[model samples]
Target: LILIILSPLYLPILNEIISIITLSYIYLKVKTILKSTQKKDNEELTYSLKTHLSGIKNFEA
Candidate 1:
């Protein structure tokens, strides 16, 4: 009878903890993805700018 009485209380608390951990994991993963994507975008932009500047230099000659 004691076991049955405690089970419900334990289960809900355990489930809530698990849910919080899962959400934190997901949030971190999304943040990592965004960071990498931003890095890639910046790299591409710099590359394009370099190429354009080079073309203008050639034209000036």
Candidate 2:
């Protein structure tokens, strides 16, 4: 019976906590995804640059 009376007071705080946790989880997942994509792009760019430089050197010889 006392719980019934107090439930409203706790509900909003609980909702806020849940929302914060969910948002944090989403933010971390997005950050991880962006880092992985950026790393892949860097690797590709480095490989292409190296290949292009080698091609130029071979042409010079």
Candidate 3:
């Protein structure tokens, strides 16, 4: 079709828009992953601390 043939004229601007959208999507996904991992790490640290304190208590008793 003639429209398809002429699409190349807009390819530059379209490509730029697509790249911006894709980068934003990727950035959001990475940020969510980082936040979840940080929360999990904090939870693990608390659990480990409780275990360490319990171990100390057992030794004292």
**Clashing pairs in model 3?**
none
Off by over 4 Å in 1: 40-61
TM-score: the better of candidates 1 and 3: 1
Candidate 2 per-residue C-alpha lDDT over 1-61 given as tens digits, one digit per residue, 9 for 90 to 100: 9999999999999999977876676566556556656757767655655665566457546
Best by TM-score: 2
Sort every candidate by lDDT, greatest first.
Answer: 2, 1, 3
Off by over 4 Å in 3: 1-6, 40-61
Every candidate's lDDT: 0.67, 0.68, 0.67
The total of clashing pairs for model 3 equals: 0
* Lowest lDDT 10-residue stretch of candidate 1: 51-60
Put down candidate 3 lDDT per residue, 1-60, tens digits, no spaces: 998988998899898997787667656655655565675776765565566556645754
Query: In order, how many clashes per candidate?
Result: 0, 0, 0
Q: Arrange candidates by TM-score, descending.
A: 2, 1, 3
RMSD of each: 18.5, 18.4, 17.8
Candidate 2 residue runs with Cα over 4 Å from true position: 40-61
lDDT at 47, model 3: 65
By summed lDDT, the worst window of 10 consecutive residues in model 2 runs over 51-60
Residue 41: error of model 3 in Å?
Answer: 5.8
